[model samples]
Target chain A: MKLISVNDLSLQIEGYFAFKHVAFSLSQNEIIGINGDNGSGKTQLLEAIVSNKTPDSGTIDYTPGVRIGYLPQENPQVIEQSTGKYLEEMRRLSKKLAVRKDQLQAMITYMGLSPYLDTPVNQLSLGLKRQVDFLSAVAGHPNVLVLDEPFAFQSEKTIQRMLDLIIDLKNNNSGIILSATQFDKRIATNFDQLYLLDGDLKNIAAEQKNEPVSLLVFHVSPNSMAITPDVEDFLVSNQDNQIELEVPLKKRQIILNKMVQLNYQFEGMRKIEN
Target chain B: MKIRILLKSYLQLYFQNFLYLTMLFSIIAFELLANHLLEIGNLKKFSLLLIAMFILSLFSTMNLYYNDSRQNKYLKQKINSHWADWSSQLLVAVITNLFSSILIFIFSLLLRDNVLVDFVGILGLFSVGFLGSGIATLFQTQWYDHSTVGQIGVLLFIYLAFSGSVVNILTAVEWLLPPLSKIIMTLQVTSSITKLLPIVGQTLLYAMILFFISGLVYKKNRKNA
Candidate 1:
């Protein structure tokens, strides 16, 4: 299902262009990773789509009655609310986007947030509060999940869990748009589509990108390299007088055939250990 | 149901933060009763107590209105954020201010107070409170962006409006905001509110307009949020 379509969106603040001539459409069961450097307007683009910022010109059409959940990049300014009440109040405000109690409990348990549920939000560490913000956005099971740096200020394990959560939501037909300044191979690989927003939203086609399977590094010795069965099963890279072999998962045989067909020479077969 | 949820949750928060004003009012009320320096009759004293509560309520209500958004943003992130938008925040102002005002009035009434004034005074205070909340809510939303500037502007306006007759200068344009006119009249001369109906009518009218306009601000903010 087409969740939202943005057309020719443009916004400027303080006479500086935040974004211009940006357009994108989101559909169900898709995870779109927006990549950019700081001040490159990744967050601004998400804001435009999430309805937080009005554009100077453009139209945003959402399929009628679509629910959205957003987690901002900053820790939400919370003073008096406990983590539990914070989530509950946000859930209430989002009427018709009901999330059952058990589901919240499950996420809480998984995040080890059970102990901090009743803790005042401001009093929690930044990372804990960030998780609360994450839950507030994801708990309602929104049709469109807009996460801006949701994994920031957290552990690697938590990041993995959040990535899995996005996948789970996608499998359930939710459209997820994630804005991340930093890149991770696993996360980048998981995105159905990647976009680099630098004033303009540019699509990084999925097929043109390769997921790293294996990295094989070796020393190149001027035509003294020997191509053997062991050395043939990898991709070859010649850089700075050194040759590195990269082996794509399950394509080692094809790489071997390519090396043999090309009459490629290598010093020795190597697989870099992690 | 949604409003109920937001109201209830915010009310809980209000009760917590409202302690500052409640304690302030309680201390002042007790000192007045203990020192025996107030020479007025019991009714006047009780009325004065309610007025004090109302004033404190106004201060705290403004504080709540300003801090609610500054402090928490969970509701702001939700899809249907109207529950915690400026209008709803103003509703919290109304509810908390009224709650404290009425509670003080009733509690003071239980004390021995002879020679009671008519309901006009209470009605006048109530209308003033409604007006105060309305204006405060407006400041909390529209003027809130420029914190220091807005606070200074509002304080100046409130002082000029209540102390002198600046509202009268703006009265020709006041019909658009009838509440300010009513507030001016009510504060200028307490006896003027004896008729009561016009005051109440203007209170409702002004409150509706403020809420409606602030509601638009909410929609606009949500659109850009």
Candidate 2:
């Protein structure tokens, strides 16, 4: 069943165009990864889904009784109070979800935040604060999770823990939509559905099953490259190069090897798999 | 449930700021000492002091609410929690005013050698002032930038309508039709308002009216929210 459906949705921010006629659906237990370059309306799309921004024109249909949880790219200001108080408050607000008070404490512990529970949030590191905010959103046990840049500023272990939490939520029949610039291969391997926004307001359609994927695109500097992959493909580009290559989805190791062998200073890489 | 959660969180925040609480207590103590040294027994003086306390408490509550609103987690979770928005503001106003009143009551008994009558009067003033302030905050939150002017205007109109003798001229000329005119007239005089209605009754009435008005404003704001 589709938990969230957005049809012909468009949004504009500060008179600058953000998204246009964007359409997508999130099914039960499906994890949809949204990949795009910076300023590609990835965050705006996530915000629109959570009702933070009203679409300029379109229809958004959400499943009744299905809660939507969003973690924005920018960390919210930390309350000058202790982490425990923050988590307790979140737990109280989400009390209708059958979450036990101890579970909240456990989640804090799992995030390596147990010792910091009594410490003021403002005193914590930026990464720790982000973790706290992330836990708060998931603690509500939302049926549809919308996470924006969950790995930003997070350590590898913390990212792994967050991934585990997402998998756990998925096992509980919850759907997840994540947007990030750099796509973790583990996440792409685990999550099948993918959407790409290519410096435009709309989502670029995925490549067909029978077609041979286009591997590279040559364009002027600053123009976003396009990828037509049969499945999901990873792209690793040189820092000075203008052309972008589409690495086979399963051969990320090979792409990494090629980049290293070519001695090309890489800008960034992401996986587009669905 | 959301209100309960917000209330709990607010109280926790209050406790966390122990230094602020200490400073607040010291200020209250200094005021009580000043009042005792002046030997002022007039109701007007007492009412003015009560008003000052009310403003102080309201300022503190607003500070806390703004702080909580800045919290990313709180704002994210609370936007969907209907109870959090209304009840948090209401609880802050009510609780802070009640605490201030209680402190004043205790101070009056200890320093002024006043009877239970003065204690009750102070309680009534606190209650009415709390309700009025709560209603003001509700308006302020809903209207955002214009709340300050709007609240001041509303309070000024209420005071003028209730106490201004000019109201009688309008009534005599049959030029103005006012609701609650009789009640305002009855309570226009301080002695009658304090004497006829017990402090509890006056406070309850004020609280009820303010709460009702706030409820209406909140309903309208929630639709916009």
Candidate 3:
């Protein structure tokens, strides 16, 4: 079922069209990544979707009862006036918190946000603020999540955790829409549907721009099958006591050395044509 | 639920601009004025002094537009409906002024020397408070941040209202000038209660119309924003 749809929306700003003939739809358990630079109408589109502002000429159609968690583009000063109050207010709005309290607690603990619970949002670093912002949207288990620049200004560890959470939400039948200026290649792999919005919404090719042209297969004895999470991140497939991965040509040597240092007894390393 | 948050925010901002401190000042001024004016032996004098101090305090505080500072656009994201936000903020200020009027009346009950109010006089003041608040709201919405032209005109209007005896000569109708003329005449001549009903009704009518107009203007401004 289509959770939300935007049909031929046009937003004009300062005598120019920020977005023209923009259209897209999001479905359950699917992720649509919007890619755009500054002032490309990404934030306006998200606000229109949430019904915060009316579009110049378009209809953002979504059924009632579909609570959308909108992470706004501008940092609201009200959220910073008091610490932890914003979190509480956000939690109060989420009717699902009564049932998902434990889950939320575990997520907060894992994200290391427990210690800073009382810290003012403005006092926190940009990265921590982003985490707090992300927590506000996810706590409700909202039907649709409209995240604007969710991944910006975050550390690698935090980014990985957010990515994991996004993947988890997708698995739980939640629709996600996000915009970013630049992202790692894994985002392409995680969200297969990507749209490039300059003046209008355009779908980018599904083919990963930096896809590895060569494949490396390593065969290890059944007793020596040991892979750490860091290595598993790049693992494409594993079966029959053999692990296959498409490591970029530039990083293959370092990855091979890291595997050797991990004491994995590999019988052979063969290169396969892409 | 949303109103509670907006009201809390509005009160916090209002106090941040020294509004709470001035409330303390108003109470102290009232006490000193009562003690000093007690010798005059006019009960109405005490009520009028207190009312003047109350108006002074209200006039010192900024008008009740959500834009405390021209740059404070924080409510745009926190609250969704601009009309609700704008109306509720103005209502809080008006209600606070109403409370002030009520408190003054309650204080008047203990006075035996001063005829602080007849039934009609107290009702006149209450109506005046509402009408003043609504006009102030409209004035701030239109010119508070944009320009001071309306505020200068308000000062000129105050001069004219104080000289209502002279101003009423231009009109032949006895009750045409409203609370200003009637209120002045009562202070000068007979303190009759019957002549006050027209002023009360006119003040109320003007207040409602101004409030409705301010709401419409605020809604349009929000849409433009």
Candidate 4:
């Protein structure tokens, strides 16, 4: 059964179309991965799926009475309260939804959140905050789980445990929707379906495909509007504050040197084909 | 069940914050110190002083309701009911204010100052507390990060309230506000229970309307965010 279906969706941010006419669906026991570059509207699309964001135009139909759990990318504004109390609140809400969280306590211990349970959520490290959010989402045993960058800021062992828990949820017939910058081998191997959200959602093969390309992400000073270096040929996309360039593998070093010579602050460089 | 959980979370958050704890205790301290210094001789003066303290404390702590994107997003995703999170916070605000009123009433009772008059004063305190919190919630929900605008709105409300008495023309426009002036007038002009009942009803009615409007505005703003 289709747990959720988003059709002809359009979302605009800061008066620019983040994505237009996007469409997708999820079914029971299915796990879908949405891959995109930074600021490609991956998070926005996940939020829309969970009904946290309103689409500019479209319909996101959900199966009646299907409970959803969402993990936001950050929790800087979370209310000041002990982590234990926060988790207790989520547990109560889960009970209200009629979901049994028998293993949830054990999971909390396993995640190393036990010692800091009395600590305030805001005082916790960034990685721990994200784990708290992940646990909150899992406690509900939601019919649909929407996680944005769930694997971020975690150790190898923690990431493995999270992946195990997610797979277990899938075994129990929970559908999952998650977004990531890129799918590593482990992710590509486990994910049942993969969608590339460049400008719209497109179903891509599960395996990571390599192309002869590299991505150059750079930041320009907010006050400066002009790039002193002439690299229009390599420019893939440019926004007011950042620019992305698609460079050939052989020319990547030349482009980096030129940008460094011109004093442009390079944010990151990643191989497009990995 | 959802409301209870949300209410508990909000209250826990409020009580845990050092600033919120300071504001709440400061209200109590101010009541004790001011009562001793002013030598409140009657029920009316005592109640007025207590209610003024309540309003001040409420205004000071209401900034906690300023729009927080992260917390709002978390609640919006976790809670099933749309109004549960907002209504829960408003309930917490009212409950804390009520706590101050009850403490004041108990003190008045212990002092053995005309039980009937003290009861009436407590009733008046309830109405104003609701009115003040309602107006503040309306502004907070309607404006994102509403510190500046909320301050301006509060100043305007205070002006309209006091001006209604000094300037005869402003009395006609006073009815549109949360009936703070009316509550004060009723407590001051007549201790008659009948006159006070109608004012209580009017204040509660205005508060309910403001709450309803705040809910609507909250939903709209949440969607836009």
Pick by DockQ: 2 or 3, better one = 2
Position B69, candidate 2: lDDT = 48
True contacts kept of each: 0.57, 0.52, 0.05, 0.76
Q: On residues A87-134, what C-alpha lDDT tens digit does candidate 4 reach at each position?
A: 777877777563455577777887878998899988898999899989
Residue pairs that clash (backbone atoms under 3 angstroms), model 1: A52-B224, A52-B225, A53-B224, A53-B225, A54-B224
What TM-score would each prediction reach against the true structure?
0.71, 0.72, 0.65, 0.74
The prediction achieving the highest DockQ against the true structure is: 2
lDDT of 1 at A78: 47
User: Per-residue lDDT for A209-262 in model 2, tens only?
Assistant: 332433443333443333333212444343444546665555545654554444
The per-prediction i-RMS, to one decimal, reads 3.5, 3.5, 4.4, 3.0
- Candidate 4, backbone clash total: 0
Would candidate 1 be rated incorrect, acceptable, medium or high by CAPRI criteria? acceptable
The Cα error of candidate 2 at residue A77, in Å, is: 5.7
Candidate 3 DockQ vs. native: 0.13
Model 3 per-residue lDDT tens digits across residues A1-274: 7889899999887789878899989988999899888888888888778766567897878866676776766555434443356666656555543217677777777788988878777788877877887887777787788888998887788888888988888888789998887545566578858888899988874433434443557776645547776576567777886777666666777777777676554444555444
Model 4 segments more than 4 A misplaced:
A77-88, A96-99, A109-124, A206-274, B13-51, B57-61, B67-70, B104-111, B143-159, B164-166, B170-176, B186-201, B212-225
Runs of candidate 1 exceeding 4 Å displacement: A79-97, A206-274, B8-58, B72-74, B77-91, B102-123, B144-225
